[model samples]
Target: MIPLDRFSGHANLYAQYRIDYPPDLYNYLLSFVTERRAAWDCATGNGQVADVLANSFDQVDATDISETQLILAAKKPNIRYQLSQAEQTPFANQTFDLITVAQALHWFTIDAFHQEVRRVAKPGAILAEWGYGLVKLGSDLDAVLLDFYRNRVGPYWDPQRVHIDTSYANLPFPFADVQHNQFTIHRNWTLDRFLNYLRTWSAVRQYIHENEEDPVTDFGEQLKAHWGEGEREIRFPVFFRLGRVMDEPVQ
Candidate 1:
């Protein structure tokens, strides 16, 4: 299992290279919080989404289990960074207008996380969670990259530990209604940017360091040999699942 603690050291690269959600996703989130009130951004790594939340809510408190991530987020204005885990948030009961988890829900213990979310979110408040996956350029070269991830990266990561579907699917929040949306964003990148982004993934970082394989040296050579060195544009899809906390038990 990939320990969560390893991320503390990679905070800067993660902050710099991780993809940001598109503006439309943020707009969809805002629709649920018509009151323009407080929102909690659970596992708010480096404040990327929290920065956007600050635009929509009067008060946005961003929290993460990793103090290193929170420390990086501290530089953002109007975002209060707290060192708290998703399973045990320190916020008071029914205190938030909305609670959002982005890209980090997979790392949480679902039962405790759901209870904590329930404790802090106001009745009928919205609970939104999202996950994203990337697609490389659709070419023979891309196949090589995909195969590398599917065979090499996916197997090493603990399937049960990193899997996120159940956490979102079995939300304890009695949702009266649920909505799912998919958004596509195109990232145009130069060779350097593309490589930097790839290197930021924890799986890739772990594999390189643990195996003593020089990702920078080997992956670069392979990519260049296959695709040549230049600029490329790739489209990535972000999946969003939004549900309203149930106000009352069904009869």
Candidate 2:
């Protein structure tokens, strides 16, 4: 069994501060899915994408290995939240119209998860995965944020993080490729809200675990002092990959 890396502790911060993907992102993905019947969102992290899918699909199965994260997810009548891993799931063959992983695909065991994807997805079903990298604030605050992300807590990031940093271009996707337009997560937030989002970073959690120091404390101080107390719009360039499941499963 693959060991579970729990991010449940970060769930609250994640639900509160992390910007949800825009409607255009879903609209683009929905175009590829032939049917809006059933969809599976693996590693559904607080049901961010799953919640969005619920509006378009008749039924949405949202799965995550972290129970704590699920507890924080907003409940909806059409959404079912379950605890399951991405690489190995109890779902049956050809069970879904679309499959999505948002910001969490890098953590999956790619080969195993790809096999599962083939088993669960119907022929021509759409498979979409995406992640967002470095937020764009203004130049000054952006520089400080970069230092905190790269220099302060870089080592603590999971090796899988490189996939996101590089925009999942290197990811081994075992599916028929589908070209897609660019999507960005654009939103406005107060400085406090943005800092809260940073605290949800896994590397930030690791930095705290190893050093017993809250790196955000210093960074937050500097950010507050420099930017003053106000809100600003932030944009995170979202990197996404789209593809269609093959009709025949790989043996």
Q: Assess every candidate by TM-score.
A: 0.88, 0.94
Backbone Cα, N, C clashes tallied per candidate? 1, 0
Q: Write the per-residue lDDT of candidate 2 for residues 174-219, one digit (tens) a residue.
A: 6776665568777878877887888888999989988999898888
Instruction: Return the TM-score for candidate 2, rounded to 2 decimals.
Output: 0.94
Q: How far is each candidate from the true structure, as Cα RMSD in Å?
A: 2.9, 1.8
Clashing pairs in 2: none
Candidate 2: C-alpha lDDT: 0.84
Clashes of 1: 1
Residue 248 lDDT (model 2): 56
Clashing pairs in 1: 174-246
Residue 112's lDDT in candidate 1: 73
What C-alpha lDDT values do all the predictions have?
A: 0.74, 0.84
The candidate that wins on lDDT is 2
| Candidate 2: residue 138 Cα off by (Å) | 1.5
Worst 10 residues of 2 by lDDT: 173-182
